[model samples]
Target chain A: MTGVAALPGTATLAEIGEQAVIATLTAGLPPAADVLVGPGDDGAVLEVAGPLVTSLDVLVENVHFKLGWSDPADIGRKAVAVNVADLEAMGARATAVVLGFSAPPHLQLRFVRELTAGLHAECAAAGVSLVGGDVTRSRDLTLSVTVLGGLEGRPPVLRSGARPGDVVALRGRTGWAAAGLAVLSRGFRSPRAVVEAQRVPQVPYGEGAAAAQAGATAMVDVSDGLLADLGHVASASGVVVDLRRDAFEVPEPLQAVSAATGADPYDLLLTGGEDHALAATFAAGAVPEGWRVVGEVRAVGPDAGAGVLVDGRTWPAAAGFDHFGAAR
Target chain B: MTGVAALPGTATLAEIGEQAVIATLTAGLPPAADVLVGPGDDGAVLEVAGPLVTSLDVLVENVHFKLGWSDPADIGRKAVAVNVADLEAMGARATAVVLGFSAPPHLQLRFVRELTAGLHAECAAAGVSLVGGDVTRSRDLTLSVTVLGGLEGRPPVLRSGARPGDVVALRGRTGWAAAGLAVLSRGFRSPRAVVEAQRVPQVPYGEGAAAAQAGATAMVDVSDGLLADLGHVASASGVVVDLRRDAFEVPEPLQAVSAATGADPYDLLLTGGEDHALAATFAAGAVPEGWRVVGEVRAVGPDAGAGVLVDGRTWPAAAGFDHFGAAR
Candidate 1:
């Protein structure tokens, strides 16, 4: 959903104040039965159906996102989507979320209202509720979202469960978001789909549970590039993963962006993060529909070196997003 | 516990990197049965005993707190304490907390470690677990804490249940923290107890459940000053709360701070915030032990005005912390 556009004479946060801004941001959110108590209380009460699953992600103004590069609504949507991906990785359906927002006092109140609208839209798409949150003034804009999900009678799919001979499968596209970033960084206009991918990733949400039901041994959401994230599963399971580069064909859109920007398509596909793709280890020949085989889990060498190998070679260390060490 | 002294050779976050920093921050924390899955996964899995009570609060440097005025450990502890207070207001015991931290890349790794130590110490104090979190790089320091609690088979004590003839009671100190803040703001060395009160409030954590069991009608934590928070109860319950000035005597420490700072004692007592005290209304003459009677809840006036009345008159608006409107 497109959030309400900023209008002339829209009150700034300083002019209208915190209470009024909060009242506007929380107004007209659809109520849920699980949310016995909503915003404005000390805390919220949720009647979770089963065990609770949770994840948290923080988005800083320029570190995780650039305000000029994305709309306020898209920022809010992306914030929710990223946290929801964590829940899906655990084979849980998101039930509710609480957001912590900080912004400057002179910021437009309309921005917060629109951001909330976007949060509502994304939560609706993921079948989650915006139950409660806290808003405060800061020097820059920051959004912290914590999502809660319910594991309705299914065992959690952990990253440490893959066994030797398990086949690694991928359920969503890779490199599109990174390709879009390459286009934007170079001051070139890319296809709308590529740009949207960079802004708000469309996670294959329910497939996580489907994979679990289909007997996936281990699962992880690809937030830190395909190789880097799968390396987590490999390391945790004490196995070595050998990925076949040929298994992943460069998509036409990414190829176009690579030609336009003179960037390597393989770099985007292998090292680009925030794809939110589901990568899992399933029994050989048992990969679920909508998922394609990408690699195989094997026993570690006699030296006990556990890692992700592309065509049986070691990849670079720190190949994905490292918040403190890497330059954005 | 005193945090590790910043050594001459202390590593900066950039040098230590995100992965190593995270590893050091999470090492050796106690585990809990409810935490079926802990950090290092996509999310944490919590076997909530019953209904889930959750709240979120974000503390920004120079906004909600100042690094110069507070120790990093105390800042971490206070962040968890304030959020736990919200759950305590709901007659819940905190079970787990998730934290989101953002800071500049050049920040010391020891600072983050000490912050985590402070978080661990506070969570241990409250019998809660630090389940999972996310960290990123930002221009300024910010900590967002989300507390999850359980009601333990009891109904949540809501703010909307106060009826006419209910007596208002308070379970903890009112003015000490605010007085401490006054002293800190004035750049005067306050008493150790007073300064500590301001930095890390000692909440009457379990008194909320006791109040519920004792038939308390309405409840809230006195975070935004006595009168302001009680106003929430009054508005939610549609009843007028009248607080008597003579009923509360000026504490000796507050009186000393008032004399030293030349601030009005009544202003500090009435409008001071961050006390983390439990304020509730119970049946008249049936207030529980450890609670001092402060006021009474009465029916709305013939004019239908429902709010907190001090000495039978309306208090000034914006008397407490309003993040956007207040002149801090």
Candidate 2:
């Protein structure tokens, strides 16, 4: 090895080129079998049986999570969790994941290892494995996760399949994660529930496939607030969704946290995000186990044109998060 | 939309969270068939027939390419090309690609658009589609591409399959990309051959599968220098490879650039990278149509551990580019 002076662990990524940095990051990791090709190739291939569902998500440091607040492992878990939620939304089970990580050169190798370990833990929880990934040195920390899922011969539940008179239901908590964010952003001391929720989201993981098997017409994961995500189904399916706030009430834990944080319970219920809850429209009848009816889907009307209404009023907040928003 | 003061087409990515940035990037792109679910879910699902192959690579700004030297389109093409070449190395046909992009807030939207366009163009060239992707705000530019491929019933060629008496052959030009980098580093004006080669690499796309069908024992892509990549085959297959320098001649266009740049042509031929060419070892006999025999794989000897030799001398250059090298 050349006797180049090694910089401290805080060196900026700009000092190194991307390729050279990646080579260092992946120097001696064990390889997996499904990964026919690993990091150095143009793409990776895994041997698998059945139909594949794929999803991709990107995470930037500070923007996605403050390093001061979250450890590297937390960041890794969150990244994997969110992407796995996408597969759940498609009514599929995650089988494998591929990661793309970009960080500055000064970042510690231990941090990356811990982060990868976190990813592996989450993958194990989801009954999948990390097949392949890439690492490059960048100006800051950024992670992109792509997950593949398998639908064991079941038809995929799409957002565009809700029909008039369908009963809308949710299978998991809808606003706890957003409430947790609100608490954290306000600089409150660590509370077990809020802190745990913030670090790693709890998605009702297997409920998506359960919902699909139970004859759910359309489904989505509540990632960007309930009203906002429902609006996507409404617009796609050309239907109006009317949600009953009382029926889809905020649970006791979330209400207590909202009260403590001086946050609007209604805002958390209607407009909060990162819940990873499974929300679906089912044919009117008995809802599946672990699911509760929360609303109804109707034909589009002048007052509600492919939109969502909470307790007879249009949601006041902007429809979820947009990347190029003025705040950026 | 909130009437926040807009920075004049010069927004930095740091200001936006990774998720919001990705939302903006994927706002209006149409997805193809294999993309059962697009960017928003936990993961995107892609349709596949038979066994699947996946590969990933990450490119950080400044490290992979100088942003000042390369426009967004060039960066995009390189990212896709490198990942696609990995799939080709497996003798599989690329089917879809998912991208993860992170950049600071000050990045131009036009740059992102151009980058996307370039990705699409490369995908088109490879007869694959840009199925889905994620974009987010970051402190620096980071691109991570994951590619999936389909192998229609053929067994994948592996690095550990070469044996004694196997003939080592090459299917495409080697070292042109490394030569191009030399030209660029010297601040030379764009020459047709050097500039074009740098922008997009030309890998023998379908030859990996062709070589496999022709009963090749082992295969790898020449993304790192030919000698370094071949070393992987040597070590994995427990064989020693002896390359005949007389047989490893430089192509005409590359020779012209080497002469003009005052660089040693031999260095380009042996130690250069980013060519994405296919190098494989076949059982000695007739090679495939587009392949040329360059050496022979010999049994490992007590004195010589599994490695590569050039023209009867052990190659002294360090094996291929490592991301964390002192030069980086």
Candidate 3:
């Protein structure tokens, strides 16, 4: 069967109407078991288990995304990707998501449908369902996604759990999305691989579970860049995390983009954000498979102010994605 | 203790900035039990039991609200209230809420804090806590709230369960909010009474559970006018819901606004929305206390589509709140 019409090639969110977008986005999603009712109702019910890990994220037009650069589907996927990454950082697996979308009335029904399809696709990949949401009229395009996750039998891994001697490890590729963003900003058509990464980040979805099973002490995602996120962990855990630059190998995909854009690969690795890779601290023994050791947690001292170090010196990168910061 | 700072009368959302808004919004709010981690985290872990009921709703500046008329705290409270109402409509009690906000980065921090205070106040009223959320920069102000609820010891009530001969009842005020809205539109601002109702429509929090315990065959909340929401139940159940207009009395508050606005009180009774009132079908007998009997469910006629009727005639009101319809 022909796949549902792809999202409009040039449709801005302002072009697709909100209700049509909702109907489109919800078309083919699987219903979660506890959902006595799904979309198109006053509300949705999800099957709850163990303790729930819930989070919410909102993306506004031009703030979280640019209509000129991202397609509706890409916007949808990015919305789910970032929220799901938060669940992963908490050592939880996302089971369901509810969305609230607001847009001008003139937006096309087709674009909304395609955006929902993209959301469903991403949810499927993450082993979750787009369960419930609300659609309303607004002056600007806004997307709000709330994710619910299950801890199963494991305790949640918090940012404050790292011990002084714990080894810091990462379970997914970092810096690639940041590098892709650099290419996009410079008006360069990203290569197929870079564009794919930029549109829908490849997160190590089940790795949070793996890390939890292997007794991860602390975990955070690289949505705010490695050093910045680690700094949060350091502050919360009262430890200093030192990263060996030599150990932070750039993924091949990012290296190519860096060469093409003539951007400093190291800056992309340390300062660029939105990679959504999982970074965690584990005990100083064997780490989980598919994870690379990059640093060690040290006791806070005179030279360290509960922060991160690069090589043997304190690394100074602006603390990640501040909403009001000039760069953002 | 000193109360939270009042918002300056002339400050716009664009002038208040994002982080300052977040800091302001979160100040002085107490946390709930399920919230292992609150705001300032990648995601919050909320303890869930049985199944989780989750939903999201977003309000945009200039479309959903006007800064010239309403305060940020009013907007924040409304955002949380509506989402919590959704959960309640599903026969669930809210446990936590996560907020996603976007605005320009020039507004004062105090205004944002007051908004957060309002959000927390509403969450407290609903027996839930403010957990994790995201903030970002946007050209317009937007508030997105995702609420997580617990469906303790009961299956969720759906719209499809009403049978012929079931009696219909309502558990909260229906026309007050709409009446308040009419008052506001006519520039009749009595901030102490009419305008406050429009800003925050009081919802009967435990009434959903009361209705559920009293054996409601089907249920919904009147967020989209009485006739329209009943139409959903009728269509879903393949039955006819006939209302006795004579039996429905407009409350005093609504009547006062109707007198002031020179609007039809009946229009507010039948077509007005956003009262957050719970409406349900019960088996023919004594319904719960605090609930007023309003209608009866009947088998659909051969020529009549399963729908709603008033005063022995088909109700002639527009279907409620279409996102693509003209803005209010």
Candidate 4:
């Protein structure tokens, strides 16, 4: 793109148009070493090696996050964070991300700048770069991020590899984001940490490779709640997972949120999703440090069905978020 | 996801929901060897070697297309095609794509299935696979496609490499799609070929590597108008590109389209975009077979400024599309 003159003041995208906005968005961004060709080309070229791990996720305004509830920066960070969590789940180091941002024409240039800044900040935290992306006009805000990662030659830990007798472990906190969502939905002034977690939850990024180094068999991000996501493992591995709720040292902030919202904290921990924690199965005595064994995998007996169970019984909780279901 | 029983008859997404719709999408799709882990996982693992190439593009409803004006399958194919064009422009062998398709809850499942089928058809034509993706509900239909390609040990042809004395060559037809768009915009029942061209314009996919092999200095897809996109080449290369309008063999269909719509055929040939044609700069007489010489790159003389000019004069025509501009 020709270096269009920057508009004088805070103008809407419609007033300044796309070319100027793109020029401004890309201005002064640090260049990446691995990116052979950066933005302004038809596409970006990267110096990638080893197995390529990729994931795509789309977050829509109002549906994914209400503009009134979170900062533009928080929304951008969350979009990158959730996609990065997927790459980390597979024991991959994220190298790059490509974003597709769609917004209304009347959207302010300031909002776009803030969103881009947030994306840059989150990518820096993960040691990745925004190599390329596209932007367009839409009726509402839309963010679609595709993350590319490298396995560094390690075999990816697949969900089907979890064997019976493996220990089910969890990394990172749970229920905080969901509880934060609960507080926000009710317009309550909840604990700051809990509320912040809901806005931009942190994933245990490095623990995936650590778990893999420690011989973890299978892994997934706890995006769809502990029970629900683990259920995917059980189905794929043909094993039953039994969780011990008492093993989890539920944080006091979550408990306070439960008290404030009058919602069961344990219930939120069990079923509320968007925590973006790393959950994996490791051989007994092989669970890595900074991880806690929360459950165990067992062969599905004829009398027992293969699914996630709590205390050797079916868990009585909501079944996590479903995009097209009544709950979400 | 539980194997929810299918709702009989053609059901809307709201009726069958996301799980069932995803099931329908992934079912009966052929497997690819490069894909170690496919859909249903947090991310897809691709067995990619060599330098990686990636590009992202988003097509929003009413902004990029209208449902009433095009078939859902055509829209899907167009999305995949446009992303594939980016890979082709970089002289990379297109390998795989991940899609993020968001639509309103009331969208029909049939429409989604048709769209996916079109994507599969187009990807198959390019010898690539739909490795994985995500779907969500939205206010308007949005398709964000990320294409992955391999450089296969070849150095990429960058836009900055075009030097004075290079010949500007183009492969594949130009202006057909833009002419087709004109016909559609005017609500005219133009030639079927022109209308189809507007919907699913084909690119000379294999010609990118061919151009690179023939010592092409720089290359890009003509997504924007020839002069405008070539202006990018000029700005990047620090040279002026002068087009010979007489050199282009404007296709008969475009001529027919122009006659029917009362549009200037030459203007359409020069400024119409979305042709997915490959334009490149090569040393004189190095233009590959099946490619036509359209222009020449020259140094910025004291009397002539750098940028795209037509037949030694500046052309008077609209420069391609701007997503956030009023015309679009």
Candidate 4 lDDT by residue in tens digits, B12-99: 7777777777776676668888888888888899988788989999999998778877899999899988888888888888889998
Question: lDDT tens digits, residues A124-225, model 1?
Answer: 898888888898988889999999988888999999999999999999978888887887777766677788898888888788888888888999998889
| Fraction of native contacts, model 3 | 0.72
Q: Is candidate 3 or candidate 4 better by TM-score?
A: 4
Chain A TM-score relative to the true structure, per candidate: 0.94, 0.86, 0.90, 0.96
Per-residue lDDT of candidate 1, residues B159-240 (tens digit): 9989999999999988889898888888975666778889889988788888888888999999889988998899999999
Q: Write the per-residue lDDT of candidate 4 for residues A37-148, one digit (tens) a residue.
A: 8888888888877889999999999888889988989998999999999988888888899989888888888887788788888888888888888988999899999999
Every candidate's DockQ is 0.71, 0.40, 0.56, 0.71
- How close to the true structure is residue A250 of candidate 4, measured as C-alpha lDDT? 72
Any residue pairs clashing in model 4, and if so which? none
lDDT of each: 0.85, 0.75, 0.78, 0.85
**Of the pair 1 and 3, which is ahead by lDDT?**
1
> Can you write out model 3's per-residue Cα lDDT over A63-102, one digit (the tens) per residue?
6677777888888888898889889988898888888888
Residue B245, candidate 3: Cα error in Å is 0.7
Indicate the worst ten consecutive residues by lDDT in candidate 2 chain A: A1-10
C-alpha TM-score for every candidate: 0.95, 0.88, 0.92, 0.96
- Higher-TM-score candidate of 1 and 4: 4
Candidate 2 per-residue C-alpha lDDT over B1-328 given as tens digits, one digit per residue, 9 for 90 to 100: 1221232335444454444445444544566776666665444567788778888888887777777678788788888888888877777888888887766667765666677677767777777767667766565677888888887788777788899899999998787888778878878745667666776788677787788788888888887799988988888788899998889777786788788877678778887888888998998885799798999988888767798988757977746775544352
Per-candidate iRMS values, in order, are: 1.6, 4.3, 3.4, 1.6
Encode model 3's per-residue lDDT on B32-99: one tens digit a residue. Answer: 66676777666777677776777787777775666766787888788888788877777888888888
Q: How many clashes in candidate 4?
A: 0
